[model samples]
Target chain A: MARQESLNVSSSPARRRGGRKPTISREQILRAAEKFAPEELSIPALAGSLGVTHAGIYHYFSSRAELVAAIAAHASRQLEPPPPGPWEDWLVEVAFVLRGHFSQFASTADLAAIGTSVTFAPLVEALLRVMRDAGFTIRQAGDASELIASCALGGAVVLQRPNFDAAALVEDLQVAEDSPVHELAASAVDDDADAAFRRRLAVVVAGLKASLEAPTAS
Target chain B: MARQESLNVSSSPARRRGGRKPTISREQILRAAEKFAPEELSIPALAGSLGVTHAGIYHYFSSRAELVAAIAAHASRQLEPPPPGPWEDWLVEVAFVLRGHFSQFASTADLAAIGTSVTFAPLVEALLRVMRDAGFTIRQAGDASELIASCALGGAVVLQRPNFDAAALVEDLQVAEDSPVHELAASAVDDDADAAFRRRLAVVVAGLKASLEAPTAS
Candidate 1:
């Protein structure tokens, strides 16, 4: 009676995990994935750490790629689109929102960098609606939203590494201190990626506005 | 004579790989990595596939991440700076050069997305030299180059996945047909990520130009 009651009380959907372990939910896999560095994600290794057979974990994900993608999708639930406002502000907020969410799941951004884009759909509807009101045609809105996300994402990827500083790169390459490359690095604030990203967004927004105002410029 | 020549023929630097296999060089790891899907990269698995132990593979690369980074760095050798010309053209060419190189090695892009910025420095000096001649302050030139790289990188990441189509995403989310997002999706031509990326670069460039032309507009 006690064993029967325990099984019933567990209430996991797929309790028969090849009879290896009683329950290993999708949530459990995602939880574990959150703790892993981007490079550390291997399905068999993930399964081993979870005390489940590799095949058992496959019940939830078709492949390791699918499994890794699901972790980002799961995290996307927490990201809410900001309320509608000025077009530039809206886009900047969206960029920041992306930075906030993906910062925790660097692998998702890494996956994007590699060739698998992790689409976070929660913000799209709101983003599209705002861009539409800002005088962009539907395609423009969609493309613009994608552009902001990409910049935000790319910026996240580039800034995620502390070693990616301009000064460090110039020095490592043996660039002369008096050269133009070194001069560019000289005036740069080494640790201010956030500020640099903000400036980047401003430039992106200005370019979009120019395109909108003078349609023939592009 | 053949046996004596065989050892000499194998001129790879690290000929001592724990006797796991007579020879496994850094070049071998890079060659293998080019064929691997990003999700399929595991140090132990890579070692096993190469008939080497994980430790033996580590003799060439200190870590899997380092191995991955080196693959990109190796490929960067082929990317040369374009001859100096119009600043805009130079920047665009640089962006294209990056796309050309990274597109073949998607994992490098993925690593940048994940938080490990892969620095490809060959073209930076020339890029800075051009930007400086175009009247940008040293910091401005550095920041602008980084911005272009980010947009190009972000665009690469977003477009790499065939499944990341706007129409498909909208359809999957059950967005209403008349809605702005759906309309954006409607105007979208799937499988034209390259065209979209090109347009995105144009906009980013325009924005940078606007910033220079009207300094306080931002």
Candidate 2:
């Protein structure tokens, strides 16, 4: 009975938070910033919209850049955990998740681009860990991480815009018979971009292994 | 003799404007915009820096957006035409030229993003013409042009960042011993990335053709 009532209340129109002590949490702040992005949004404007003081925000974020970084971190964390499987298969799964995550929060890419100076190091380090565990040497891990993220993020940014639809973009690839954009598609000259991605992934992995085998340049 | 004097007068810092009159021209305005992009750069700032009244710009560009669009068009025309060859062989060549073009004008990508809205229709038509001429079917030409342009442009935007050293980025992929970045010694992962890009491009091309052959779902 309590669960049913809570669901009903949660689904109702958002309550106007005026008459009470503003209980703005970090999540709420991040959510607000994400909502107002790609527009002429300012920290003060966000605070005003949330019925909170600008000064109060400093309790959570030290600066506007920091706030943007926090939002990026929040958005990045929203991505699902990489699936448990063979390294090759899991790598593709991870790329797909990343593609979806970036698509969902495409505006955040621009916001994150501006705030990159803050501390993407932590997130980058985490990414490296995933790659290492997936059988990549540190250097191979580094390049693979950068390339994968770039493709996914770049693809999402293109997909989210008005002129670029993500599904249509994938459909254009005509990758597989059962599911054209699915993992089953063969690497045709014009149809299977995923095949191209996998080939690239394999090369990076092989290169990394070769580099590891020969530490010094020949 | 006048041309010789103009070319040789470089020893003298002081030279008359083009060894002729200072009358305004469309080329002159656009050239000035390109030259002044590195400094004070608002519409008014560009006009002021050029020692012209803001209204004076209207003779060449009717609006600020038009002025920006013209600069982008100028840069686009100045870009190296994609090399004529096998698709894979020339694709990286195209990517390199695009990277250089975007890097030349720091904010040109952002401007192009805005300008594509106004120019997409005509641009698409021209792109289709080029692709068809290059051995693609009407549909393959249409879809491939859009997808490939997006990839190249998106790659450029990501690669032209302050942290992204293009020389370093491509070093691993160059197979030739004489390549400059090859001296930098690419990580195994970077080699893989080069391979992956080739595969991805192939897939995109093949998929595009396949999609052309099949009827798209309703």
Candidate No. with top lDDT: 1
Query: Please, what are the lDDT tens digits per residue for candidate 2 over residues B18-51?
Result: 3333335566677888776543446688778778
Best by TM-score: 1
- Candidate 1 is graded, for docking, as acceptable
* Deviation from native of the Cα of residue B131 in model 1, angstroms: 1.4
Top DockQ hit: 1
Per-residue CA lDDT of model 1 for B104-146, tens digit only, reads 5454334453223335366766777787788776666766777
Which residues of candidate 2, in runs, are more than 4 Å off?
Answer: A1-37, A43-70, A86-89, A100-136, A161-218, B1-35, B43-70, B82-87, B104-218
Report the Cα lDDT for residue A99, model 2. Answer: 59
Compute the DockQ of candidate 1: 0.41
Angstrom error at residue B188, model 1 = 1.5
RMSD of each: 7.3, 16.3
Q: Name the runs in model 1 displaced over 4 angstroms.
A: A1-52, A107-109, A113-120, A163-168, A176-178, A215-218, B1-53, B107-109, B113-120, B163-168, B176-178, B215-218
